[model samples]
Every structure is written in C-alpha cells, then in structure tokens.
Target: MKNTLPVTRYYGSKRKIINQIWEFIESENLEFDSTLDIFGGTGTFSYKAKIEGKEAHYSDIFKFNTLIGKALIQNNTHKITDAELNFVLTKDDNFNYKFFIKEIFSDIYYLEHENELIDIMVQNINRLKNYYSKYIAYYALFQTCLIKRPFNTFHRKNLNLRTNDVERQFGNKVTWEKSIEDLFRKFCIEANSYIFNNNRKNTATKSSALSCTKTADLIYIDPPYVSEKGSHVDYHSRYHFLEALVNYETFKDYVNFEKLNHEVKLGKTLEFESKTSISNDISSLIQKYNNKIIVFSYRNKGIPSIKELKNIFIENNMCCRICLIKTHSYALNKSNKALGEYLFIAKPKK
Candidate 1:
C-alpha cells in the first residue's frame, strides 16, 4: 500500500511501524467496522485506518494535532483549492493582523523576519471561509514551523543554533534559513495531497483519552512515553509554540513567563506521563474499552513494565499477546541502547 499519509516529525510517532501494526491487526483478525485512535498524535494511525476503509475517529488534547486529524482524517471532501491557496498567500490590507508572535516570540524560536511572516500567514489563514481549509492551512503552518526548528521541537530557545556562525556538527541551517512563505507553500502542497474521501464519516475530537464517550469495535492506544528512569515525554513543552499558534487568542495566559522557551503551563495533567499513575491509567482505559479489542503501543524502556500491562489485560478478562519490533535508538537519547517496540494486543475472552 502506498504510504500517502503526510509525514510528521513528532516524537514517538508510529509512522515507521504502521505496516507492522496492520500486520498484527490482520493476523489477530481484529478487523472492525469502526476504530478509534485515542492519542492520535500526527493522526498517522487514524489516516491508515481511513485508507483501509474503516470508520476512523481521532482525538487528541492538543489543538494542533487535532487540526491535523480534522484536515486529513475527518475531512473527506474538502481540500485547499488553488484559489484558496492563492488567498492564503495574499495579505489583506483591510484587516488588522495580530502581532502576537512577532512581539512575544522575538528571538525565541525564529528569526525576526520569519516571525513576522508567521504572523502574516496565520492572519491570512484565519480569513479562510471553510473550516477544513483553515485546518489545512494550520497543518501546513505547523509542519513548516517544525521543519525549521532544531530537533523539530520547541523544548528550548535555540534560535542561535540556526542563526549563529559557530561551527555546527549538526542542524539544517539551510532549511532554517528558508523563508516561511516558501516553507508554508511547500507544506501546503504536501497537506493538500493527503485530503480525500473514504466514503465513511470519520470524526476528530479534541479531548482526553478517557473523556471520549465514543466507542468503536477497535481502540488503538499510543499514550505518551514515560521512561523507567522517571523521565517523562511532555508533548506540551515540546510543541507549545504550535499550541500557542492555534490558541493565539489566549496564548499569553498559558505561557510560562519564567521559562526561557515560554513553554505552556498546561492547565491539565496527563496521568499517563506520571510513573505513579500510568498503571492505573492504562487499567482504566482497558476497563472502559473492555468490550472493544485493544491494541497498545509501548516501548521496552517505558515506566509500566510489559508484565504489569499483560496482567492488567488478564485482570480485565481479556486474552493478551505481544509482538516485539527491534527499532533504532530513540531520537531524544541516541546514546541509549536500542529498545524493542512492543505492541500489546488484547481481546475479551471468548
């Protein structure tokens, strides 16, 4: 199958293992009329499900990711038209655009000129008439921001890494120096290529995994990874700029002024990111979706051990199986030994 899904540089994305996941689903006969991707990061899994002719539902707490889901998964017929793209590229003189990114984000993430361009492009995107068109534009903008940043993350204020004349062993200075207008147009074309109709009504929601009231025949869970050493992968901190971009109306309130990078002080906490609470969180999810087949993706080095997770499945009266995939070293900690990617498949006892 052609991997037509838009590529995302999101950490812990399942893009590489999606084919293996499909193999597991087929081998286990876990085919379903409908499927839900709870953590829907990058919406790759949901997009894969849609490609397979299933009713796909995607949910994420982050507005940026949910917008990706809306653009690629939920939105079937709507696409960015040539005229719409032309409009997004054009600046309107009538409407006064907000300079929030330019004013507050100076010297933090992008060059001064790049920041100004983002401010202008986002304002143009807001003027789009169709909701899907807006999402498509946002999707492009988000990808463009990520591509220009070092490590493709906003974990630190490292604009100097891109601009400084220091000898750099790493980093793509050329891509970073590329004009935001050009990058935006490039990503818009990439995003436009992924939009299509699967004939079923797929939906995307912005909500926590446990809060989603929707049920499906299959539930795919790929929660945030917390290391056994107590380190947590906080998506909010890594992609706060994207969050700020989408929530520009209230961005200032969420930003942690005390921090150099201005990472968002998130209002809500994810239990899955806390080692003490992760086991319970996984158990709750299993119990809540007990009627549906559960497919979970985890790393060998994650906080909750494989044995504990399997016991949780058994305790929930479900038959469990595991598949191990040897993968490259994690991007965040390349020095660490390579880890196995584990996929836990569970189904109610017959």
Candidate 2:
C-alpha cells in the first residue's frame, strides 16, 4: 500500500548495497508469514522485506537501531512535514537567519544556543493535535543536524563548532531551521504502512535474523561480514545520533555537553559476536527449518569467508541454488568494498 522505507543508518547499515543483497529473496518463491532480520544493523533488510509483503521481524542489540526498526519498519509515521517545517523556518526567519547553521553539538548544546527555537517548537507542537508528523519532522531535522556536527562520526560527544567569529560567520550552518526534503516527502507517503504498534511478538529483541526461528519458509541471513582489511567497521558510531532520535523522549531533560563530553572515538562498543560465529549458529538453525529454503547474503566483512561459508552451507544440505555476485564498491575503504555478497540458495542437504 506504500513505498518502502530505507533502514535507518545504524552503524552497520548495509544500506550501501542491500538492493543487491535482497535480489536473492525477490527471485525466490518465498512463502512465510514473516521475515526475520538478525543483526539488524540498519534494519534495511527488514524494511525491504516488510515492504514486499512478508511480515518483518527485526532486531538489534543497539538500543538505537531497534528503535529505528520500529520507526521505519513497525510504525511508519511522518514525525515531520513540509507545512510544519515551513512554519518553523518562517518563524525563525526574522532572526539574523545566521543562527540555524549546521554545526555539531550535543543535545544540551542546542538547548544553550537555540533554546528559544526549541522552546517555541515544543510550545507550538504541543498545542497541535496529531502533531506526530511535525514531531517526527523535528526529529528528522534534529538527526540531520547531528551529521554536520564535528564529532558526529565517532559519536564521542565533543564541542566541535568553530570559534566565535568563525561561528558568527558560519553560525547559520549550525542553526539551520528545519526544512522539508525528499526523504520527508517519502516519509509522508510511506508512513501509512504501519497499521499497528505492538512491541511484543512482532518485534525481535536481538538480531531479527536470529530471533526469527519459528517460521517454515525462506530464511535470509546477512550477518555483519568483518571487512577484508582485517579492521572493524564500527557502525554504531557512524550513526550514533540514532540513539537520540529514538530516545528523544528521554532527552527532554537535556543537559549541556560543553563540559560533559567533547571527544569521539572509533573504539565504540560492539553489539554482537563476529560474523563467522554468528553464521555458524545460523547454519545450524537452517538445518532445523528443513521444510523451507535458507538464503544468505554475506559480504567480505559481515559474515563468513566464501570458502568457510561454502563448507558450512554446502555440507549442511542446500541442494538447489541460485547465485548473485557483487564486486564491492569503488570506495577505497575496504569497509566500503562489498566483494562476495551473494545469496546462498539451498534446501537442506537431506
């Protein structure tokens, strides 16, 4: 009934190439009430699967990504809109128009500088009914703002805005007013898919792929393939701001980060085990679901080495097969390359 939603950019967002990743499922004669997304890095796989007709059951260890799953997959709603953004921008227009520039700062940082705008937003939206769209829009803007922040990449919490004159000259960047964009338009069109919001059964608490073990249909696995460069790609920090988006309610009591946090790091926490370990477990699970075909799309970094995977899945039983290939991205970052991402099509070896 609605367009598909992209998985929010949780750290490990395979969003870079999930389109290529999902063609395997699309070609198959999938039969099942639900699709499971384990290691729900960005929930991209889950969202796509859900949009296509299968009941999507997604999970992630990150408190942030799971909320993304809910926002994008489970409860599709426009948290913002064109009209509301126009209004917010218009109201702030009288100001020097230099205040809304996109500079990086903490939740408290915005409260300190843009307190007036934030206050007005709360007041106006509170007065309106069915303001969910506007509320979401506010978040979308807020989330967008995080990216332009200096410390946003590693998400370590640092005051990275430029100096006074520098900020004065560019303060407008950090304080840019909320505006409607293409995704916002899509948000309007796609928000209709969520007909319900029951966080209990339909949702998976961990990776959606692993938690969804009950079904007897095609099971797809796209575990985190540790990149080929032998280095880890901490997806968590890459999209750390997602935590704020989902838990904005908790941020209402926002405090300043000028003194609290000011440095970001690549040593972010890992939410789950390595891909090989996970695939080993997934391989076993596929054996149990003998009646259904098991499909997997693994890249060089997220899951198994092709040789390791071939040994595991082939020995287990998948007889009939369809293969799709990926050559990796043009990105110089091995983390960006996606070699070996293919759908391992098979019915259990028995």
Candidate 3:
C-alpha cells in the first residue's frame, strides 16, 4: 500500500519506522478505536492510525507542529487550489508584508532574496480565508524551509555551507541551491496530494502533554529524546524559525537577542527535557492515563533506561511488554552503532 502522507525531514520523526511500529501494534492485537499522539512530531504515527480508520488526535507543544497536524491529520478533504497556491506564491502590495525574516535573518538561514520571499509568503498565508488553507500553506512553507537548511534544522547559522565554493563530502548541494519559490510550490502540491477523508473526526492541539485532559483508548507517548549523558534534544531551539512563522505577530517579543542563531526563548522548561525529572515525568504521565493502553517509543540507552521504563509501567499497575527494533539506526547519529529503538506497550491490569 502506498502511504500518501507527505513526510518532512524532521528530526526524530518516526516516518521511517512507522510501518514497522504499526506492524508490531497489529501483531499484538491491542484493542483501540482512538489514539492520542502526545508528542506528535511530524504526525506520521497518528497519520498511520488515521489511515487505518482510527480516530486520531495529534498534540504537540509547538504551534508549527500543530499546524502540520491540522493540515495532514485533522483536515479531511481540504486541498490547496491552484489559485490559492498562486496567491501565496505571489506578493500582494496591499497585504503590508513585513521583512521580519529578511531583516533579522540575513546571512543566517537563507539568501537575502529567499528570506524576503519567506517574509512575503508568511504575510500572504495569514490572509487566507479558510483555516485549513492557512495551515496547508504553512505546512508547505515549513517543508520548503527545512529542505533548504544544511542539517534540516535551524539550530545553527550555516548559510556559508550552501554559498561557499568548496568540496563537500556531505549535504545536498542541489537541493540547497534550488529556488525557495519553486520548493514552496512543490511542497504545496505534495501537501495537497496527502489530503483525504478517513470518515473520522480527528483533531490537533497545541498543549503540553501534562495539560491534556482528553483521554483516548490508546495514548502514544514519544517524548523528546534525552541521551545517556544527560543531554536533551531541544526542539524549541532547533525549529525556532518555524515556530516564529506560525506565531509571526508576537514572535519578536520572545526572541532572544543574545543568541547568534536568534533562537526563541520560552519562559519555562518542560520536566521531560530534564534528566533528573524525565523518569518522574514519564511515570506521572503513565499514571495519568493508567486506565488507557499506551505505546511509549524510546531508545534503549536514553535518560530513563528501558528497565526504568518497564518498572514505571509496572508501578502504575499496568502490564508492560518491551519490544526491540535492533536494526533501526538514527539518521543524524549514525556513528552510534550500539543504539537500538524500543517500544514499551502497556495496558492497565484488569
């Protein structure tokens, strides 16, 4: 079966192993008619559930990710029309397009002209009438931004890697040099193609997992990765540009002028991101949904070890099973040959 879901080069996205994960879930015969993907990065896992005719609810802390969830999962039948595509692609003088990206981000992420194009597109997309239309446009824009970046992340200021004439052992030089306008148009079409009706009412939310009161039959928890060395992957710092795009109006207020890369500074830190608190956080989360089935995606050697995770479920009065995907390798961390992907499937004791 052809998976019609449009995949992005998202860090820690499960698009590569989604089918395998689904196969495992199906093989176990775990019963669930609805799913709540708490982290919902790239929404591929939830999309897989949606395609299987389950009611999918996608949630994330970042507004940009929620927009992606809206465009792909919640949006049943909306597709970007050619006229609407052209509207976002073309600049309208009446729209009062600001140069937030162009002025502040010059010599940072993209070429000057490309940054200006991004500024224009963001303004135009905001003027779109339909809610899903705005989200679909932003989805395409985010994909274009990600594809053009060196590491597919805005964590570093590395435009020199694209512009400098040097022998490159890594990176897609051609894709980096491609026109942002063309890339935007291409992704817009790709996002549109992924839209279809699954005959279920799916929803997307931008809220912390701890704050989510809505319960589902199955809760899929794929929290941010915390390494064995206590270092955590800060998605906020990595994708601050996309976050700013979604919250364009008030983004300047949250900008940290101290950072070289101009990362957005949020007020508080999440407990799950801390090495000391991650174990407790996971335990608390599992306890919160103690009565529901949960599939927790994690790495073998993460902050809270697989043994600790198994114990967490057991402590919550749930029967847990650990499944290992030993062949899996991370895209960015290829040097770590010892790492393996894991899933802890837990259901409350009857």
Candidate 4:
C-alpha cells in the first residue's frame, strides 16, 4: 500500500488530519473491518481506511468528488501509465474537442490558452475507455484547475489575481503560473503513487449520505461544516468548475449564467440544508445506520453542536464517545487560531 495520499486543497478536506482522526477511531476500540465514508470529500479518510487493510467504501453527492473516490479508493490496482498520461495530455486532431470551457469560461478562471488546454484535456479524459483510467485523468485535470486558481476554488471570477500586475504578498504565484501540462503530469504521477490493492472489493458511489444504501462495519460521517454564525460551506458553488468537468456532456444545460461566476446550478443537496435542519439530517443519518458503528466528524463550532450531536446518539439509544483534537483553521480563513475537531464514536447500546 502507498504511504501517502495525493495532496489536495479541497475545502473541508480531512487530508491534513486524517491520521489524527484515524488514531481517535482506533482508541475507541471500535471493532470495525470495513468503513463507509458517506461524505468522502477528498477520499483521504477512505484511502486511509484502505491503507489500514479495511474495505473502504467512498460516496459523495457531487460527481467530481465521486471521481476522486473512484480514482483513489475504489481503484485498487489501476495506475496511470506513461502512455496513458501522454495520450491524455497530448491534443489529438481526430477528436473533435469542443472549446466550451474556453468559450464559456473565458476571463473567469485561467488564461485563454490555459482554458483551451482544459478543453483538450477534459475531452481526452472523457474519451478514455477504462473507468479507472478516465477517473484518474479527471483527477489530474481537476487538480490542475484547482492549483491554478487564486484561492484554489471556483468561488469567484478573479483571474486578475493571477494575471494582473500586482505586488504579491500572499498566495504562491509560481504554483499558479505553472503550465497546465506540467501540473497535470505532476498530479497524475502523484496519484499513481497512491494506487495499490488491499485485497477487497472497495467501491465508490455518488449518492446523498442520508440515502446511501451501502452499509459497513463502520459508517464515517463528515458532512459539510455549517458554522454557528450562519456561515456555511457550499461546495457546489466553490468547486462548480470541477463538478462541471465530470458532467461535461450535459454542462450546457445546467449552467447558471446569471451568477457572475457562471456556477452550474446543480440544485441544493441535503448537505446545504438550513442550519436548523442539519440536526434532523444528522439524526436521520445516524438512525439509517444505527445498527452499525457510526463515527461522526465535525467541528465544535458548527451548527448541531457537539452536545446536540451526542444527544442524537442518546436519543437513538446508542452509547457515544467524543474525542476532541485542536487544529488550525482553513488556509483561507483570516483567523489562524486552533479550533476543536470532534470525532464522535457511537454504537447501538446493547
């Protein structure tokens, strides 16, 4: 098994603290051999579970994220070969590549030439025959798009942040200016290092956590963080560009052109429900998998506070244990103070 996961700057990704989370899971003495990561946002936690020789199942509502899970967790043996990488990176004349990314997304994210490259790359990725190969290519392409952006997000149309002549105080300009080919190749190589068989039929699915049908020895729930201050992370808005790439065939139909950012309106998922409803969402999810060991990861500051969550476990007749680990705020946040990362391990009371 590989010793490292591909680096990702995905918002709310647990890549940085997956070890801490896993250690806490271990200390709970939870006898779990298989894990279902329902909200598997970077798939790092599921990948870690796979690394630990468990059957790791990853699921997410967004197609792009599901691609990430498919590439890393589900795909145990497939790695991007040198020939595959060259095929995806190189532009082919036979394939009629559409310039939708360039025409529709011009002046929104990357430079004109960079946008053209994305058009070529995504088209080539879509053309790949193997499921794992296609997902891996998409993974590399998504990473390239993310790394080129100013905030590593598609939240705004701020191409000038990387293009305009301004004194850079923050953000890595060198990384931003890296060519699409170089970044795509680098990320694909990094992704290749993460593929290995753990001798299990691991899988990835695109589904809402509440409605996910897969059950395992342990159910890992790390829903989108909703702050008590009424602020929330809407991943669809932040990473719509990458999401569109996965659904590129129907991309034109879903484009919400009214928004300045031209974000694809994929509609509000359960994760983006109001702060009040999240508690019920949590309650319903836990009840759905109450028979299995349920491990919930959350921030102490979020809505449905740690106390509220524990109450849900009690109401469901499940004994629970909460482990708190202090961690720094996300890189984009102004406040750098450490905050509590809560992991609640609960099982149906005997």
Candidate topping TM-score: 3
RMSD of 4: 1.5
The CA lDDT at 343 in model 3 is 81
Q: Which is the leading candidate under lDDT? A: 3
102-149 per-residue lDDT for model 3 (tens digits): 877879899999999998999889988988999999999999999899
Sort all candidates by TM-score, best to worst: 3, 4, 1, 2
TM-score to native of every candidate shown: 0.95, 0.59, 0.97, 0.96
Clashing pairs in 1: none
Question: How does candidate 2 fare on TM-score?
Answer: 0.59
Q: Compose the digit string of candidate 1's lDDT tens values, residues 1-350.
A: 33586788888787777888888888987658999999998898899999999999999887888898999999987878878877877777887888889888889998887788788888788888999999999999998999999889998998888878888888787888787778888888888888888899999989888788877899999988888874565887888889888887788787777889877765347657777898899899999998789989988767778888889999998998899866654554456665778988888998
**Tens digits of per-residue lDDT for model 2 on 1-350?**
54444423233346667666566556765556676666665566776666666677776655555555565656543454456654543354343432211233434234344534444443443334554554444344444444334433434443435323353433345333333333333444444344333232355344334344445355656555465456564554445444433333443233223534322222234323454355567566566555566666655544556666677766666665647565554222445543554667767555
Off by over 4 Å in 3: 266-268
Q: What is the C-alpha lDDT of each candidate?
A: 0.84, 0.50, 0.86, 0.85
| Candidate 2 local lDDT, residue 183 | 33
- 42: Cα error in model 3, Å: 0.4
Candidate 4 C-alpha error for residue 287, in Å = 0.8
Positional deviation of residue 49's Cα in model 3 after best superposition, in angstroms: 0.3
Q: How many residue pairs clash in each candidate?
A: 0, 39, 0, 0
